[model samples]
Every structure is written in C-alpha cells, then in structure tokens.
Target chain A: MISMHLTYDAQKVYMKVLEECLKASSIEYELNGWSEVKLKGQPALSEIRTFKNKLREAGIYVIENSRHELIQRTKDTISEMILHQEDLKSPKLSTYLTEKLNYSYTYLSKIFSEHTHYSIEHFVILKKIDYAKKLLLESRLSLTQISYKLGYSSVGHLSKQFKKTTGMTPTAFYNIIQKRNRTL
Target chain B: MIRGFLKLAVVEDDKSSKKLFQKAINESTLVAGMIFFQQSNELLEYIDGPQNHVPDIIFLKLDPMVKNFLKDLRQVRKQHQLRNTLIVIYSSGASEQLIEDTFVYGANVYMDKPHTYEKFREVVEKILKINFQYLESNLNIENFIYRT
Candidate 1:
C-alpha cells in the first residue's frame, strides 16, 4: 500500500536525483553525512534533464535505477527499531532512526521530502499502518499483540490510525481480507 | 579481464516461488550464478550501490509492489545512463495489466512462471539459443554499419 517505507536504494537514488535535480536548477546545496541540518527551497524542474546531462559530463553518477533499496532500507530500520522495543508505546523510534542513519532529523526529512513527495512523518505513519495491515492480514496476532509488535502505544491508537488510513477498523479490515482469501 | 559466471538477481516476495525458480535454474543448463532477494529493495541496491554493480539480468516476481518498483527503476536507469542491464519480469500471478505495464516500463521479456520444471528449462534453453543467434547477428550488423 501507500504506507510501505521507501526502499533504501530507491531512497538513495531518489535523494541523489533530488540533489542533482536541485543542482541542475542552480539551487545551492550542502550535506553533513552525520548531521543533516539545512535546506532552502523547492527545485525548478523545467530544465531538469539538461542539468542531469551536465552533471554526467562532470563524471558524477546518480543512482540510475529503481528506488527499491531505499524503501527496503527504511522499512528494515523501522522493523528493527520496533523489534528492539520492550514497550512499543515508549519506543525511542526518532532517536533510533536519526542515530542509526546518522543524519539530523531536519536534513533527512528535507531530503526525503524533496525526493519522495511526502513528509517524513507522513511516510513513517504510512509504514506503520502498512506493517499493521500486514500483521493483521498475514497472521492471527491479537490487535494488542500486533500493536505492541509494531511499537504502537495502545490498541486504541492502532485502531484510530488504521481506520484513518484504511477507512475501515482493523477488525473489519481483517475480516474482509479473510473473506476475500477464502474466496480466492 | 576477469570472466565470472553470469549473475542474475531474482526478486520474489513469496518463499515457495523463490525456491521453485531457483531449483529450476539449478537443474537447467544456464551458466549463471543466482543471488536471491525477497524484496525489490535488495535488487535495487545490487544495481546502484557503492559498487555500482549492475547484474547481467534481473527477474522481478510481479506483484502489487512491482508496478511502482518499475517506475522507480526507470529513474535509476535514467540517472545512471545504464543500458547493459536487462530486466525481465516473471510471474505465475497471471495479471495482464502487470505484464503490459512491465513492457511499457522496459522489461525485456514477460513470461509466465512455468507450471512445470521442464517447461522452465525449455524457456531457458530458448533464451540462450536466441541470445547466441543475436550475438552472431549483432556482429554482422556492426560490420555492415561500419562498411556503410
């Protein structure tokens, strides 16, 4: 669904494309491999291809294909983060991601937003719900158990977010998927 | 120049299909090494990671995730200016829309994951024969172009 994390390779190539896409538009850039701290504005995409070729002429290569790795990495990190938590409600998710990825929240968010067409918060929520859907559909884990597994604070929170994203409550959604499966 | 076994990345989310396909490949006469990854992410990384090691061919197991994956792969191909790699989509999922979309996104071939292992072997044999013929014709074409 829309909630699956952008794979890491896709994220990398995506950010590189975003970086080059911005560079092509004459927007200045900066990076701190450990601490992402600054961003300025939206990119001009009118002459994007021209700049892409120009960058190529300079011998710098951006990822040339799929964003699969990028999304995969992000999900892996999220999964790992949740997997480590003893209490899903009190997860140190933000700290874990920032520390592990070695980028300031601001920079990661900015670059991700520039590349993905979604904000980091929105993306993370999508990922959580996607995982929840997966857990809900694939296994018979109780809602509370799935919530804890997903690092959710409570079943209420999970139900609320699940409803928000899927337009159906978790129980309802699971039932539908179950009925659909039986038919198939 | 170092010559290595041809590398193929097989992307499939399902475990059984992955095993079945790998078994089929192993039993076949193809001179290749197989690296299996369950998700598109690993496949994408193999192509664009720090090594920039694009495989000779990639077989994507078509599913809902594949459509968006192809779209993203297009960006990577464009950014890297890569042409040596061939992407082939295989699925026993049997979705016409998926097959059509894959071709639209530049998949080299879309074939059903054969029902029988022998059928899989036949497909591989045909692919190899075709490539050998293509190589012979390719040399001729280059000679003709140069002469012209």
Candidate 2:
C-alpha cells in the first residue's frame, strides 16, 4: 500500500499509471508503495521493458531503483516549495530535505547527482528561475518583491542568477514579452 | 509594489475612450500599474525597447477600420514572451465572424466595450476579480473565450 496520504487527484493519476503498467505486464504484482511493486513470478526483461515504456508514454516517471525514487521525491519537494514561495528563513533546503527524508544531505546529494547528473543546488536554482519566469509575466510584483518572494538574498542577487541562467536581465525578458504582446 | 495588484496595459486609438478606460482602471484598487498606447505600433515599440515591463493583462480595443491591425496582432502574439499574458479584446462593433476570428487568434475574453463610464468600470472590476491562473490550471481551454 502507498504510505503517504495523497489527494484525490494525485491518487487518481498514480492509480491510472499503476493500472496501465499492470495491464501491460502479464505477471501479477504486489503493490509495496505507490511507485514500488513486487512481481509474483520472475518477469522477463522484455516484459519489464514494455511496462516501463508504457509508463513513459503516459507521462509518468519510471523509477528504476530506490535511489531514483528518492531523487524524484527530492525534486518534487523542491519544486512544490518554490512554487508556493515558501519562506527561506524557516530552514535551509538541505536541512529541510534531510529532516523530511530522514537521510543525510551528503547521501542525498551524492545519489541525486549520480542519478540525475545535476547537483541538488543546481537543480534548485533551475527550478527557482523557472518559477521566477512565471511570476514575472503573471504577477504585478516588482523585481524587489519577486526577489523576496522567491527567497533570494536581494534583488541584485536575483538579477545575477536570472541573467546567468537566461542570458538576459529580467527587464530584458520582460521587454521581449511586452514587445510580443503589442506586435499586432 | 502593492500586493494582489494586477498590471494592466491599454491599447486604443480613441482619445475619449482611452481617457475613460484609464479613469476606470485608476479607480480600482486591484490595478497596481497601467500603461497606455495610442497605436499598436507604439505599444510594440515600447515592448521592443530595453526598458520593458510586461503587463499581466492587456485590454486590446479592436477597430473595425483597421483590417491589418488584427493580422498584425496575431503575428505579435506568436512570440514566446507573450505566451503567458492574457489578451482581452474590447470592442464595440464586433461581428460574429470577427468574434470567432478573435478566439481563433488566441484572445482570452471578448468584451463589448460599454459607452457609460460606470459600466466600463464594472466590467473592468469583474475581469480583475477572475483568477486567471486558477482557470488556466483547470485545462478547459474552450471556456477561456469569455464574452460579455
């Protein structure tokens, strides 16, 4: 059984993906968790490959191993945090993840990089920039307000990161959007 | 910046209409920032310049005389930056064909511009009250083209 409590929508999406995978493979399986399954008989490599492909086609992540699953959870947690504009002062990301997952940051970082080919810090930066982009075009907040909302140290810090990631200043990006909106 | 404010941009050529529109927007607490353009070209130019501040929502007034303007607007909307912004078409003499065309061209709302300032303010307030992001996440694109 899946241990974590999921909303109705989340459960529906997960169940659909699970049902699809089960249908693709003839072997019976025991559900250990939402993403974990135990096959009754030793399934052939071909059968597993087919099931994986079906899940991918349905836009679901194929968890190869426990490490991969942990990485995915980390990513999901970080994204949700950034999307909600969670305050930075509460706890550092590493500390929060460590406490939430009950794993040391060192172990988490090592596994994350090994599986995802990106550092946890780098992934956080990318997610923050993506969130910033949406906030810029969708909200009336100024750069200063946006910086604080995203938990950047300051407006200057946010600008530097934004420029480094996007190859242009936030103002420039805004201008491009503005120009696009008025073209007609 | 004021919290919970909506940034608005107005693109219209009629002087009286522009004045009324600005007055209505200014009267609303939801409006944090606003910019006006007499011609679509002026708005385009402002956006192209280095000092661009993208608005969250745009109030676009369509003129019947400017056949090329609609075509130009469609072309402008093709850019990536404008993808997230909501485009609301404000028109007085919209034919059924033009309304259909506007929806096809990716407008989110089709509003008949009211003559009275009071009515205009009410319409603007109603539009602002809508949480566009929430509506978008629902993924029902068909209902996006709201008419008034």
Candidate 3:
C-alpha cells in the first residue's frame, strides 16, 4: 500500500461502493485493500472474472499479483529523506529502513528478495546510482562533489560503477546528452 | 447510454500492470472517463471532493491490510456520506473469509485479473454492459429515494 496519509472519506467511498456492486454480482473480493490479495489463488476462476467486472463498474483500479510494492516503498523512503534533508549515504541506509519501518533487516531483505528477485543491497545501490544519475543530468556538481554528496568514498569508485551501469563515463554522458540537446 | 465517455479511475500499485492498463484504456475508444491513481488516498480525495469527481467506476488494486484498510473505509463512511462510487477490488488471490470481508467493508466489484489480456478485455466488456443496465435502473430508484 502506498502510505503517507489517507483521509477517512476516501476509504469509505471505496468500501461502500465496492461492497454493493460485488454482492449483487455474487463475485467475492477482499475490498479492504491489499494488492497482493489474489482471488484466483483463493477463489474459483469464473467467480474471479465476474468480480473483476464489478470492479470495472466501480472504477476501482485493481492491481493483480506483483511485487512493485517493495520498489515503490523504497522509492518513497528515498524521496522522503532526500526531500527533507540531503547527504545521506548507503552505509546507513539499511539501519535507517529498519528503524523507520520497524522490521528486522533480515526479514525485509528476505521478503524483498523473494518477491522482487533483487537483493535489498543491490536495490539500494541502484537507487543511489539513480540519485547520482539525476544529479549528473540536472545539476552543475563536479564528479568529485557528486561522489562526496552521494557518500561515495571517491570519484574513481563512482566512475567505475557509473560507467558499468550506464555504458558511458559521467563526463561522457553529460557531454553527449548536452550535445544532443543542442542539436534538438 | 450516458453517451459521452466512460469515466474510469484505476488505483493499482504495480508499475508494469498500471502501464498496461493505461495503454489499454488509452487505446480503447469505449472509455471516455479515464483517470489514474497509483494509491488509495488520491482516489479517495477525488471521491470526497465537493464536486466529487467520482469516476463511474473505481479500480482498486488493493495491497495487503498492513494498515487496517477496513478501518480506512469505515472512516470514509462516517465522513463523506459518499454513495454509489463503484469500487472494484482486484487482486491475484484471497481466502473465503477474506472475500466475505470485502463485502463487509463495502466493495461494489471484485475481480481477479487473469494471465491473458483477452480474458481481461472480456471481463471489462462484460462489466461495462452490466453496469450500464444496472446504473440506468439504479438512477431511477436513487431519484425516487432521494426525492422522498
């Protein structure tokens, strides 16, 4: 669930309208909210179809089975922290997530991996690199300054990974994109 | 027929699925009312507004009740007096009791999206047809009730 805050009225509107429609159609559902709640995995297949029809009526966008849940969650965490304060590093990221969400690092890691097929640490690295990509494309920061800003120990380390993932060195990417923009 | 556009709202969390839904809806000439929200709160806000841009339907790809989703609905019931905002809860799976609880908390539609897009389109068509009839009769009764 995307969680920041939710008003009571929205929740009521969802539950009330959804309940009335599905019951009439005799299609069972878990209206309370959980994208991972799979009706086919639990209910009969034909019934699931009828139920889905009812949802379309309500304009309730239902997401079937999937694991982008974790990806979105982590993005929210990153965006929130970065928006509020800058200069956080990955060394402390695991601990921060653990503390903020109140789950053991092990449990979060396991669930995230099982669902997403990506290790939590790798996901974090990807996010940090993503942040670096934004800065490189959008900001005037020097590579050394960006390395320090992203908590990389040094510019060489940042360059090695940046080139590996993006297929261009930071300077090369910046110049290339800039030139492309000029042409446009 | 309302004969303008089919107003629709999609509330799903998965990015790939959401993209597909948007693409499908955009390509379809049948849908006139198309809006998208990734989370519940945004959809809820639209439902609660003064003009209440209530989509003719709302598609809620519910997440697990990690935070008491039922409670959220009950709160809305108390606050908005919102009526007829069709809510469809689509998930991959659920239990018998959980399914029952969907009604207990108030869901108008419940669907489990299948693997095939053909089946998906079939499902969308069927519901649109049914609701078109249902809404027509429903408006009459609602008018009778409200007038009294």
* Candidate whose TM-score is highest: 2
Assess the local accuracy of residue A15 in candidate 1 as a C-alpha lDDT between 0 and 100: 60
Per residue, candidate 2 scores C-alpha lDDT tens digits across A1-184 of: 7699655787877888788778767978888867667777655545666877887787777655676568668877887777666455655888888888899999999987654445788768766776787778889999899998988879999999987654457876565546535533
Q: How would you encode candidate 1's per-residue C-alpha lDDT over B30-148 as one tens digit per residue?
A: 33567888776666666667887666566666675445766654443343423545556676665655554555455545666677878876775444333222222111211110000
Q: Which DockQ-derived CAPRI band holds candidate 2?
A: incorrect
Candidate order (lDDT):
2, 3, 1
Candidate 1 versus the native: TM-score?
A: 0.40
Say which candidate scores most in lDDT. Answer: 2
Among all candidates shown, the one with the greatest DockQ: 2
Clashing pairs in 2: A184-B72, A184-B73
Collision count of model 2: 2
Candidate DockQ values, in order, are: 0.02, 0.03, 0.02
Chain B alone: TM-score in each candidate?
A: 0.72, 0.86, 0.76
Q: What C-alpha root-mean-square deviation, in Å, does candidate 1 show against the real structure? A: 21.5
Model 3: residue A109 alpha-carbon error in angstroms: 59
Let me know the DockQ for model 1.
Answer: 0.02
